[model samples]
Structure formats: C-alpha cells, structure tokens
Target chain A: MFDFNIVTQWLDTLLMSFLPAWATVLIECVLVALAIITLYAVFAIVMIYMERKVCAWFQCRLGPDRVGPWGLLQVFCDVLKMMTKEIVNFRKTDQLLHRAAPFLVVTASMVTFSCLPWNKGAQIIDFNVGVFFFLAISSIGVVGILLAGWSANNKYSLIGAMRSGAQIISYELSIGMIMLAMICLTGTMSFSEICQQQENLGWNIIRGHVPAVLCFILYLIAGNAECNRGPFDMPEAESELTAGYHTEYSGMDFGYYYLAEYMNLFICAGIAATIFLGGWAAPLIPDWEMWNEIMLYVPGFVWFLMKVFFVLMLLLWERWTFPRLRIDQLLNLEWKYMLPMTMALLVVMAICVSFGFIWN
Target chain B: MENKSYFSGLFSGIKSLCTGLKVTGRELFTKKVTERYPENRKNNTVSERFRGVLAMPHNENNEHKCVGCGICEMNCPNGTIKVESEMVEVDGKKKKQLVRYIYDHGSCIYCMLCTRSCPHGAITFQPEFESAVFSREALVKQLNKPGSKCAEKPAPARPAVAPKPATTADVTTPVAPAAPESDDKVAKLVAAAKKAADNAAAAKVAAEEAAAKAAAAPEDADLKAAADEAAAKAAKLAIVADNVAKKVAEAQA
Candidate 1:
C-alpha cells in the first residue's frame, strides 16, 4: 500500500551484504525501533493537541490559541518546555527504579504500536498470537506506574499506584473476555489473518451481528478504564491524587508518563478501529467496481487514520462529558455490571456459532 | 425485584449520560459562543463609560480644548495625567499654550475624576480598549499636538477667566472717572479751566461795556428789557457752574 516495504527491502539487501546474518537482523530491528519511536513522538503531539481542542470545544472555549496560527505550535512549545525543565531528585527514595520507570512505560506503549496495522501489510510486526502479545505487553505499563509510585516514596503516588493496579487488573478481565468473543468469531490469534477474515467476512462488528456490537461497546468501556482515562482515571485523579503516580516527577520525567498515557490511548483507539471498523478497508459499496476504485484512490492509510481519529474522538467526548468515578464505583462497574453481561453474551454467541446461525 | 431494579438503575444511568452527550453534541454544531480573542477585537466594544486609559482627543485641525490650567493634574487622584504647557506667542499675545498633554496610562487607575473635573472637556477616556503593551514607557505618550490650540476655543481659553480680558479692557480704558491713577491729568485740566474762566470774565466785562454804550445811545424801553433777559440767562449759567464743581469734587473722592 505504501513505499515503506520497498525501502525496507532495499535496506535489508544492503544490510545483508555489509554484515553477518544476525547483525543484519539486529540492524533491521534497530531501524524499525527508530521508526516506531519517531511515530510515537509525532502521535503524542497530534493526540495532545486533539485532546485539548476536544475538551475546549465541549466547554465552549478556544484552547491553546496563542502559540502559532490557531495554536498549532502549542505542542512543540510545550515539548520544548518539558525538555528544558530540570528533573528534581527525591529525598530518601529508590533512585534506580525511579529513573527506569518512565523508560519502561514509554517502551511498553511503543511496543504496542508495533502490532497495530496502519495500512494493508504495513505493520512493524506480523507475529502469530499478535492479539495475545499486545494484551500481555500493554498490561506491563501498570508495572511502570507502580514502580514510579513506590520509588517516589510519596503517599499520594503510592495510593495512586495501588489504585491504578486495581483499576487495570479489574478492566483487563472484561476487555479480555470481549476480545475472546471477537477472537472466536475470527477463529485466529494473528492480527493480519484476523484483519483478512474481517475483510472477507464483512467487518466483525457486522459479521458477529448483535454480539459484535455488545463486544464493541464493552470493549471500549473496558479499554477506556484500562487506560485510566476519564471517569475511570481514578489513580491519577487530579482532584484526589494531585496527578497520581508521577506527582514527584518533574520535567521530561513527568512528560514521559504523559507521552505513555496518550500513546496507550492512540493504540487502544487504533485497535478498536482495526478489529471492528475494518482496518484500512474501505466501506463496501456493492456492484460498483468504479466506486470501489474511486474509494481506493483515497488510499488505505487515510481511511485507517480517519477511523482511528473517529474512535479517539469518541473516547475524548466520553472523557470530557463524564464525571470521575470513585475507586469502589470503578471496580463495581467492572465486576457487577460489565463482567456478567460479557459472560452472558459469550454464551449466547457460542450457541449461535455451534448452530451455524452466524454469517457474514 | 432486586435484579429488575439493578437493570433499571443501569438503564437510567446510561440515559442520563446520553442526555449529557446530547447537550454537548447540540452545542458542537451550534455556532461557537467563544471569541477568537485578537481576531474578535473588530466586533467587540468597551462600555460607553469604560475608562480604559486617559487620552486627549484632538479635532481634525489637530487642536484640543486644554488651556493648560493644570486642573486635570490637580483632579487626578494618582497624579497620572500631567499637562506640560509652554507659554507661546499666539496671535501676538503671550498665551499659555499646551505643548504636551502627558498622559501616563501605565499609572492610571481609571477613576474618571480627571475627566469629570476637566472644565473644557478636552481630555476623555476613548472607547479603544486594546491598551496592553510590552513596556511601561510605551504607554506614556504626548496627547495634544504642539502647533495648534483648541478648535472650539481661542488662545488662553480658561473658562473661569475667558471673558475677563475683553470686558475689563472696555471698562478700564474708556474712563478715569473712578481711578486715582489719572490725578495728574485731572489737575492739569483744572488749571487750564481756571485760565479759561478768567478770560471769560474779561470778555463779559467788555461785552457789558459795549452793551451799556448801545443802551445809553438808544434810550428805548425795549433795549432795557433785553438787558434784564441777559441778566436772567447769566444767573442760570452761574447755577450750572456751581453743579460742575460739585460733580468734579465727588469724582476725585
């Protein structure tokens, strides 16, 4: 779909001739890593600005409007500010863990982006069990949050870390079950294969019918909670925790956590878009090959970005509109409300699949 | 019953949330109520009486109403508005003209006391509200133009003392009737009057001699009656002379 593969192939042949087999592989991995990091930085700038603009619009305000034309340069100016700010040292704290925590967080989010498909066959990795790997890898961000809180040696950070741990663990189960429902329908553990299944069998949200719709809603709610955003963002709740686990962090140290949170949001939105909205696949308009050709002229990456940003806007709308959930209420929402419903929907879908009622 | 209530409560929560989204969604499509700030300055307006900063307004001819009485300087609570006036030759007169109306906008509190107390209404707070600037010195500006006086006024146009010059010149220059400064001229005129009185007495005696000769030669009753009428006229003239001396003495007092 893009010239990225052509460049990758050229680099692979060039690296292979100059170095040993393993060294060439290592060099390729380094290149991909560099590309993902660059994407992460760009994604953070765009997402932060979008979030601020969305929040401002909901409240009838013009957000960040003085930096450049319509405040387009605000993110760059803020990043510069964060980079130049001094990192403050904590008294009587675990220095090593504190230093390693932000790196761990940013790394986890960057790794998650590797599994997401930007266009057809343009993903960084196409490993089998990509969904399982993504689920497992994304949960590791909470460990960084916990480390940052514990190593800071502050009471609020510790409480926030504990809350985040509980919140992520609670939401992860429902998200897992919802994904399981969608996964059974696709009958695969690989992302590319799963995306291809949707393309062949009409997108899962339509293929799985009502069950897919239920899963989509439940998945978004759980995903929102999983990222600790909006009503579910109790751990780093501004009113309660004064900014949660990274309270003691200053400068780029705090900025790393911020970047991680936004990256997590984008990946979640992208995953939602990929699994449900047909990753980079144009909307089907049957019996019109000319129309299909016209749509493809717009490119798959633009469609992918449109769907991703649409999902991101949905998340932002909920964040700005909903009030913060209390810690007990957050857990109650998962265990009492979402879990039982997810289980019932799974049983109903299993029976439908066995009976051969499910169709594209 | 309990299970139904739980389901109902969840439904109600979702419904309320949907309601909130509806309001926000409706507003999203509606025209934004927020100003784009610097872009919106063209449309917005300050209040009619909003005193943003002190300013001296000039007419099209580059003239203002300030006569440089320093009244606004005295009326300002913070002494923010200073009037620096140099005496200039306007119309061949040493008139106190306004060289500079120093309006220190940085220190102004906008109390409206200076505008209210300005007698000629020369200085006022204009409705232009975008007064913020980078430096304090940029706010200090000379308001009135140096070359011209007020359009609605002549030179030295202090309202309190404007009419005094013309009226006082008319009253003082016309007469020394009640002034002691003209005493020397009055005394020289009185000496001249006494000499004129002696000459008149000598002329009257000569005329009386000529009249006696004519009367004695004619020897007629009609001529004797004419002499009696002349004696009566002389008596009336003597009465007028007594009143003039009395009036002159009263003026000297």
Candidate 2:
C-alpha cells in the first residue's frame, strides 16, 4: 500500500501545527485573493467570447472564427488590441477621481471575494458576520462609480452613475431583507456556519417550506440588480449612454472597471451558492458518513467553483435572452414591485419559521 | 369583475419566473448553430448565379466585337464605359478601329447592355465576376487585346438567274409586237409613274407614322395601350436599356 492518506494527514497536521496563526491567515488571504482574481480574469475572458458566440448563433451568423480555434482566443486578441490603443483623457476631467475610479471599483470587487464561503473548509475569511461584511464591502464600489461619473464632467455619465447609485441602494434593501430571512432561518451570520446549519437541517431552501423558495428567488433578482446585470443594467445602457459611468475611462483603467464588473458577478454567484445551494454539501444518500468521507477527498474549492460557474452561466443566459429594462422600469421594479413582494415573502417566511413549518 | 388578491399576484410572479426558467433551460440544450466560418465555407458555397464581379468575353479569334460603336458608352446610365477609337491600317486602308474599351468594374451596375450591343459579336458575358482588387486601376479593364484589330468578315455574293428563249411566233407577230412594245413602254412609264406615286405615298405614310410616334410619346397612357396590342402581335422584347448597359460594363470588366 502507498499509505497516501497517512502522508497527507501528517503533512496537514504539520502545517497546521508549525505555521503561526497570523502568517497562516495572511498566506490564506493572499492565496484566495490570487485565486479569485485569476478565476475572475478567466471567467471574464470566456464569458465575453461566449456572449459574442451566443449572439452570433442566435442571429444566424458565424462569429469570430479567424482568430483562434473556434475563436476562443478572439477576446484575448481584442484585449491586446485595447492595451495597445492610446488612452484618450479629456482635458476637462477631474484628474484625481477620474483616474482612481476604476481601481476603486476593482478593489471593492476583489475585497468582496474575501467573505465568500466557497466550501466547508475553503474560504478566504470565515468570519462570524461574513454575509454583512460582503454586502457592506460590495456596496462601496457604487460610490467609486458615482465619483467617476461626477468627475468625468459628462452629463450622460453623471446621470448614469447617479441612476446606478440609486438603483443599487434601492435594491440593496430588498436583498438585505431577504438575506435577513435566510439569517433568521440559519441562526448564524458566518458563511461556514450557514453551510453547516443547512447540512444539519437539510438545506434551508427545502427546510423552510415554500416561502423560503420565494425569498431565494427574490435574493437572485436583487443580486442581479445589485451587479447591474441585464434587465437591471440601465446604468451602463450601451444604447443610450455609450458605456455610462465608464464612458471616459480608457486603457488599463477601462480594463480594470470591466474586470471589476465580472468580479462582482463572481461574488454574487458565490453568495447565491453559499446561502441557498448548501455550499459544497453533497446530496444526502444512504451510508451518509461514508459518502461524506469520500466527498472530503475531493477538494472543497473545486465544488465551490462548480457551483459558482453554474450560477454564472444562469446569469449570462438571463442577460442574453431578456431585453434590458428602462430606468423608470428598473425603479418601478424595485420600489413598486420587488420591495413589496419581498416584504410579503419575508413575512410569510417569518410566519412559517414561527409555526415550526421550517425545521421539523 | 372581481379583483385578484395580492397572494394570487405573488403566485403569478412565481409562475412567470418558472416559465422564464423553463424557456432558458430549453434553449441551453438546443443545438448551437455556430458555423465556424472559413472551415465551413467550402461546404456552404454561394450559387454560380450570384452576381459578384463582371467580366468581358473575347471572340474565338481573340478580337473584341466593340467596333468602336458607342452604343454601350451612350447607353450606360452611370458613365462607367470609356471607349476610345483609333485610326489604324486594315488591309492597306485606314479604318477607325476600337483601340481601348475600358470598363470600370467599381462603377458598373451590371446591366448587361454592352454584350447585347456588340454588333460584331466580339463581346460576351464571361461569368467570372470575383473581381475584388486593391487598386482602382485594377478595376478598369482594357478590353482590346494587344496588337489585335477587329477581324472583318467578307460579304457573300449573289447567284445569277437564266433567261427564257424568244419564240419564232413571237417574232412573226409584228402587230402584236408593235402594240406590245407601245403597251410595254406605256406600261413601263405607267409603272414608273406608279412607282413614283407609291414612293410619294410611302414617304407620306412614313412621315405620318413618325409624327404619330412623336405625338404619342408624350401621351404614354394611350400609346402604351396601343403599343401593348401591337407588341403582342410583333412579340417585341421588353429590354431595359439601363440594365443592358450595366451588364455590358460588368462583362467588359
């Protein structure tokens, strides 16, 4: 026998024992950040190509087949082209905020990944208030957008940024309320604790009855809006405002903002997977302990990636199929429709929890 | 009408979401229609009849049929044709021959007129239309082959008819001959007079027809009705003059 398990367990024990707590935390943070950034970059590149191909397929045209194999490297080539292009900065822009905005947005997006519980033992920071921390940190990116818009001295950019700020803030309420309902059911704010709670109580999605499903759906919509994704992407309305808030950005700054948008998408997908899909918990089967033991051999990070990619695909599918909403329509959806409906769902969920309908 | 309750409305939203998801789910598995072009171009070839570029055809003798006849040049609505004739020695006699027949493919409308108008039967449609080129000069085709002149064909000769022999009975009949000669002279004079009269009548008729055509040209409504009836009997070809010009330019290119 090779005795692989013994060696692995020994190595794990040695590392856990020998490493200083602070150093471990620092190393883990750097590793996770690097992983998220890498994943985000790859996902953005792939998604851009996928979107173009999907559009071409729908429209009955062959898309970008000349660049690389099946045009997979077309986006990379386009990125290179963009990199070589001159960065045109208008003379009237506020030199400081206009330049700093993209970095701020990207930084905020990167930080949100810190709280995402990829799997049972795989997370950058498994803090007690992980959900709240993610929400708080993610919201700050909107300020950067607003600042960029205001500093650009462009009327369209300013309007777009203002709209985005209002929209994200408005949608955050419904999203926060829905998450609160999940928190109430789970009885913990820590992401890993939430995942463990679901495993113990058989997925909050199914355990908390019908209303929980409604809350989950509500969370998805709110999250989509928060990311300024389709149906709610009025702020970056390409048709009307060119590129909206980032209309003035060029070169690497523009790329950073673009990267940040996708990173936000990645974070949103991670949150959805963690909160509702039971993290990396395998479906219960007979000989559950044995199955859990087998599952442990498969790294938790891989399962987390699978779940996130699935959610991301779903988001992209929604983006491509649906027509974008008008600014007025977006506001109406939030204040008039989503807000009241989510409130009702929350009330129903709370009632269901009180009546012992949630956990048996 | 009874108003729907808030709970029912909420249920409707859920139903719509499910419907949306179902639609997306169906599309996710549907065969992707991405045709990787360049790889698939050989299989998905365009039809031969597809109008791409215009090419001019040379005759069997490699001589152009243009004959310096500016019919195509005149007929082209878009000034795409440029024909230049030069005086050259043909069979030891100076003759005006078509030197340059330059057709701009870029400006050609592909109307096919030039091929139709080539009286010498030199120009024809070649059907090799893929004329994409980098320079403007490449688009202008000089149709005249180097060191070649228009080949002239000789006219065919007419055959002679045999005369009938005069009989002795015809010679003996003096009275008949005198009467017949006078009659023949009178008849000849009469015939000449009749011929002159007929010529005058024909001239009048032709003049009347020309006047009628000129007058009727403006009043197209009545003229079209009459023309249609006449055309039905004569089987006149409905040739669009502009389209013919375009085709000629395309062929020349």
- Interface RMSD for every prediction, one decimal? 1.4, 3.9
Candidate 1 local lDDT, A1-360, one digit each (tens):
343467677888998988999999988888878888888899999999999988888887777888899899999999999999999997788999999999998888888988898777678877788889989999889899999999999999999999999999888889888878777777787787776676566787887888889888888888899888987889988877898899999999999999989989999999998888888777666677888678767666788899999999888888888889899989999999999989888887787777766867
Instruction: Give model 2's DockQ, 2 decimals.
Output: 0.15
TM-score of each: 0.67, 0.67
lDDT of 1 at A250: 95
Task: Give the range of the ten consecutive residues with the poorest summed lDDT in model 2 chain A.
Answer: A1-10
- Per-residue CA lDDT of model 2 for A1-360, tens digit only, reads 122345435645666698987776676567656877786678778767866775554444556778778788899998897788777789999988898888789888878866776555656667888888878888889989999999999988998899899999999999888888888778789898887776666667777768788777677788888988887899899889988998988887888887777778778888888887777655444458887677666655566678777777767766655678898878977898889877888787778777777753
Candidate 2, residue A183: the lDDT equals 82
What DockQ does candidate 1 have relative to the true complex? 0.34
Report the CAPRI category for model 1: acceptable
TM-score of chain B of each: 0.48, 0.43
**Winning model by lDDT:** 1
Write the residue-wise lDDT of candidate 2 on B49-94 in tens digits. Answer: 5555544456677754457877778877798888899778878968
Give the CA lDDT, 0 to 100, for residue B56 in model 2: 48
Structure candidate 1, residue pairs in collision: none
Stretches of candidate 1 off by over 4 Å are A1-11, A17-19, B1-4, B46-253
